[model samples]
Target: MRTVPKSYYKHFSNSEQIDFQKQSSLITLPQPRAHPFVPKDHPFFVRTDLTAHEMGPPKTVRTISQEAFDEVVKENMEDLGMEPTEALQDAIQTLSLQGVDLSGIVKCVPGESSLKDNPLIQSLERLKQLDLNSKDKFSDEDLNEMMGLFDKLIELCGGNEGSVNAAVATKNGGVELVCSICYKMRCGSKRVLDSCLKTMALLVHDVQSTETFRTGGGPKLLVNILIDGNEDPEILNSGFAVVAASATGNEVVKESYMELKIDELILEILSRQRNDSIQSLYDAIRVLLTPDDDQVVASQVYGYARRFAKIGIARALVHSLHAGLSSPSLISASIALKAVAVNDEICKSVAENGGIDALLRCIDDSGLQGNKTVARICCSLLSKLAGSDSNKSAIIENGGMDKLIVVSARFSDDASVLQEVMSIITVLSLRSPENAARAMEAGSGDLAIQAMLKFPNAQQLQRSSCFMIRNLVARNPENSFCSVMVSRNLSDRQRRTTKSARMQPLMH
Candidate 1:
């Protein structure tokens, strides 16, 4: 090659020099040798050139393809004997720390136990264990962070009943964490307490946890929060929700209302007269005064029922009934008002507050008849209210008899509603000639007799219907109700009454 320059030969190995000369068009330098063990065009070394502005930046770790990354993660997880879920969680935590793109990774849906073990929840657990005695030992930022973590945990759990119970179990005793939070809430700044109360409301979801809250003195803690934080609607509403949740199904918790003075708190919320608080106040009142299956709690509820009326809860409920007659809360309120109307004085109060008209409207609501609970509750309250002559006249004057007859026929298939409607009509017909006249005028006597024939097997309905028909006949002997009963042989004792001892009360 005309004795190729040594400068060209300097860069080439002897093996590369022969091949370079054979492949070249002119006398060319040999290409630099690449190791045979490594690929000549591998990207790892191919794109290594850096521009001037990037010279100071540290080299990044090699980015792996997503398939390789997943395979590596799966292998590591398998090697460690970890569940795929845990591996994903670990990956998410790690990638989040490194600020990596997570677009393709599957997110974790934590279970009850997994949620309890979350880092944020663990931090809250530690915060709850902190020595309140230490006072200023913890900075305000630390406390705020603790409460904020609890809020985050609650939001993450999303009020799932299982997650709620799991969180409660993680704290010791059902409500230790809730009680601790409420205690902190009472003293926290408005914003802090409001957030804390929100967490409390979420935690008090089920009956067991709610009872634990009541026994743990959660109600007392919340009452103080409401009393002091009434100006803050968030705190007020959240605190009320917690109390309502706690008292919802647990009669024992309801019994604590008087001791906690929750009635006054409800009235306080009501006294603000804010429309937002109306539902909260009604919920609290309903839980406090609604009868439970437990007789002791029912008696206590009965005793406190009049107190709610005296404090204008009865009137507010009636007003709410008029405002949202089709609302479920009003349905609940009407049932609660039944408990209140058990007290004769409170029944009079219900009428005085325009409750009779409202109640009749509720009974007459075409949409309300489908909800058996609403129909039965409305009828029960009307029956109790109709015990008084004034309320009886008010009911009749407000088309009460017509409403009862319509509900009876509409829900004729519902034994409970039919029985209640027949009972109220019975109460109106008993020893009241004008009510009897109105019942006849409105064709309630025919409905009652129809209910009798329709539900001959429902002993309560049969007894109520018979009593109502007999009263209709006694009030107006010439009325066709007597002729109908006689015609159907419903007047026969064997067919009209049941032999069950449970039906004896109705027989009398």
Candidate 2:
């Protein structure tokens, strides 16, 4: 105030001058572009100046979201004022580019189709133009598009019959070709294959149950279109996969094995003996093992096992038994052996064809991964065949008791395998205590005690082992060493050793 100091006035004037200049200036900034990848909204929005020295042209490789794809597809259908099929196809192509997820559209059930009723599917069918074998014949583009459409229909198919015809309609036959190809590939797809499998089981069932198919001409209709009459193993093998998965646990599918014709198919499929054939043979055995409706199927099972025992088929089974020594086809090989073991006729064929020796050979092989399983089954067969004194004597004479005792030590830690083996021994002991005595002499108590200690929790195996222990002690009080050996097995859990880069680690 005192007419502020002149120096103060000079500082204040300088600050006021700066504020005046800021208020007078106008700011200009660049505008934002609509495209996230591009910088500006113009056609060449990426470039700040259109006439600036150019580099390469702008690149856009944006992958849209699934929601965006469905919207685009729906909008295209709506806009297809005159040409709906072309519009729908265009939308499908466009959406395919956008990466829509299509995992579950094959059928509502095994053999059924839900395409006719779904709104999206209805829209797609409105765009349908079935011209098989033509340029339009289910073009790869259409196939890709139509396959997603299958995700909406996983219910109707039991697997083989019904609306499979509608899924790939074709006038030129190319569509049908691609259609079957799609199904073949789909057989491996997890989402809709359950439906596909159901349909296949129904197909096998329909064939065996129908007098027309088994006795008349039903196989002709099915095998021609389905089994391929020896052509296109993809079609044949795929059908077999469905049959395998379906018939594995489902009884309705198993009865289909009764027909003498399924045997022919099984033999034909096995004739190849390739991995695919191995897979099919496994499936055919499954179909036989779990037959649902027909009691007569057992006779067919015996017949097939016998036929195989007499020729290349029996050799194949033995080879499988040998392989099972490595990484046996557990379920399939089990059924194969069971096919021979369960039926009297098959057992006769096996013995007549020297199967016991084959089993013994498998037993003798050293360093087998699943040999214990094979041994258990072999022992079971021996127990069954030993209905007479001669049978028991033959088993002991072949060193059966000794061989089983040695093999038992290898899988003592694997409770399930141990249980199986001990179950076999229990049967032998019950049928002939003298054989049990021989088994104890062959060191059965030692193997069983170790397994019991290792797998004390396996009730079934424990029960069987308890019985075997009594049998062993009864054979000789000197075998108290077996109880000691089993007691030693109980406390030790297999330890995971330190892993080095060079060593292959053992895993549980």
Candidate 3:
């Protein structure tokens, strides 16, 4: 007999119970299917037996206010009997180790005023507090103290954050203050004036500050400095540096300087044999002569260059390139020469004034001394001078091709110098098959191949080398065979090292 559960009978009515009994006797149920097996470590497997209490409590985060932190520092100083600075440092270290953000925290000792909080501001305030009645009334000690303060300000303004410091200083009237100081001490001592000029140079780096300086008679003041301190190299260097720094990219400022006859003044300085201020003097001239993208400014700059050339600046530039000058001075002079050589006549004049021989000697000397920068600049100047037909003949006649190849080999590791050298070769071999032959004979083809192989990543060097090879092989068939052979060797070397197919066209 089959028995029914009492709970099943409770769900049926009296009349439905009879029908369910008949149906239950005929009904048949299917078997249950088996479940798939899953490993306990599988991500989808859940532990149904675990409870929330077994997972432990959540982590509690604690935060402290600035006032509370200050109280802790006070306790460290009072209870532990530590120095105020020591106490502050210890509190900062302990909190920082615990992953606390300590930004916006003042990092100075306690009880110091906010003025003393920043050294730059403190220096500015000290300078402002000075009583500049007259230069005569100030003692030597007073002047020395003022110079020291200025030096401190210079140091502050010459850091990695110098631009920001300059902005802050300008906002606080630093430019006007320095100009006032300069006017008061213009006649006092050369050392003070030098420092003041240098300080002003660093301050007027931005356009706003430069405009302030320009509007506040900075150009006339610097011109006075140049005129009064012409015999003093330190004063002249600082003065010219200010001029260069102030006039960069500011056409209005440049016009103001030109109006004050700055070009004529610089020519007068360059006429002297003093090598002390050569860098700053050349830098100032380069900045003034350099034109912006505006056509009007460029035209004005062209006229300025012509005026400079007529005033004997070419001879002065050539005169400064003597062998006795240092590498830095030589580099500056070469750059200045490149800038002023704006025309064929100017270029020819440079060559006529012993420019070729002087440049070759510089390349040789600087290459031997391992001063690659001087060598590079000399090669670039040679390229610029090679624009003229007579200059090209002069450079070749003076063995410029051989000198360039020698520089190429010496500075094979330097992509910049090699680029300059190859460019000069390209310029010299523009139309003359004779110069092309001279270049190949001087081992320029081999140097070019080596440069292409050594600096595969230097796109400009690669382009320059290809141009050089093209020029070498374009007119002179004899050199073409040599270049093809060099290219084959480069191909063999390239096959061994890298599988890049880009060098194939360049090689051939």
Candidate 4:
């Protein structure tokens, strides 16, 4: 259960004047344009009363102790960030779920002053009558009903753990009830699209699913709410859930949101830091990957990874990969490393800003397993970055030689990993074969390169020896690698000739 700050419930529950929602769930204009209202709240409006339970048994109840109530109220006032009196109103409304609305219980006492006890409810019921007499004012009862739904949601998530699941079940099963309620507020008007939102707003704040609000099309309404802007924090928070839910869907789910330009919202979520941690970024990616739309995918990746990639974001991801290289806990570290790998741009940006050195440090410091794999990837990256002779030479001087050897020697288990190490070395050698011969002489021989060579190996790395030989030939034609092979064969021939000459003497 995500515990909301008390003020979140407090101020949100009470202080909203009846007029705040009074404007006739009415749409500003009608028909030629589609009604903007997203839910069918009332029978007259959208007819969506799915979440509204038929006033059933209090499926669960608990009389909140005074201290518990005090803590809740304190949290409301302090944590929820509302004034105490306003907080009290919020508390009464929230506590109504446990069948402990202070006013309701106090008034239950025989002969208690009806005036002081249950004043808010009594006032609302009375204001409703006055509106009947006073001609065409907002019916306060509507505001009261809205408040009732809000209270139910608070209790649903806030209630005892056993009951919490039941509330979630009801919400997931019959969420449209809120739409029906809003429809009633809209008064059957054709132009009343925005009016549908009052109903949606409740669901956004109230609904929690078996898995999450993101599953199903629940996020669509939340997206709808965000596009409207001018929403309260509660509304925006629900919108956050919508983005989060998008991660769980298939093509249909993604299709439903394509019309919404979900990319902008994603950008807003990421760049705005709504989901900031590594785990949060993981979820953000998970949702983004679900949408096959390239524009949306790129936009979200651009949204978070790009904005911070230039900053320290890449470092954190690389740090994990480096740390994981030596870590015994392969599962967790590998998972994190994969997340960092999601965006190739992560690697590019890291290179531009000295990510290689940072990565090298990780290899140097790694305790064991994490070290070799990390070194291998780093070598792989350096090779890719070495786009030209200059780049290859730059990496060679920037410690690629030593790093590649470490990677080649240590991460000998995976053929693919080894191939990458070879590829990096090949690129370096290609820049200057003298460098290749130096590497080959240092221990990584033709045999080592042969071990990694395969049809699946990256094609660029297949000829490290070729590049070195070519350079060696240029370095000294008389002692070129090919010529040297010829010289060694000539020496053996001479030895055989000497043996023949001695045999001829013996025969004579």
Please, what is the TM-score per model?
Answer: 0.61, 0.49, 0.72, 0.35
Report the C-alpha displacement of residue 362, candidate 2, in angstroms.
2.9
Taking the tens digit of each residue's C-alpha lDDT, what string does model 3 give over 134-195? 44335687678879988987887888877767766776678998888888777888888789
**Model 1, position 192: C-alpha lDDT score:** 63
- In lDDT terms, how accurate is model 2? 0.45
Give the runs in model 4 whose Cα sits over 4 Å from its true position: 1-277, 280-349, 366-384, 387-394, 429-438, 446-508
Please tell me which model should have the higher lDDT, number 2 or number 3.
3
RMSD of each: 21.9, 21.6, 20.1, 23.4
Candidate 1 lDDT tens digits, 154-189: 665454444633443434332576466557546656
- Candidate 2 residue 51 Cα shift, in angstroms, is 80
What is each predicted model's overall lDDT from 0 to 1? 0.61, 0.45, 0.73, 0.41
User: Which candidate achieves the best TM-score against the true structure?
Assistant: 3
1 or 4: which has the higher TM-score? Answer: 1
* Models sorted by TM-score, best on top: 3, 1, 2, 4
Q: Please, what are the lDDT tens digits per residue for candidate 2 over residues 13-100?
A: 4554344233212212234335433224221112233221221232222333334434444443453331344344544443232222
Q: How well does candidate 1 score on lDDT at residue 339?
A: 61
**Candidate 1, position 86, lDDT:** 55
Please report the TM-score between candidate 2 and the true structure.
0.49
Candidate 4 worst ten-residue window by lDDT:
499-508
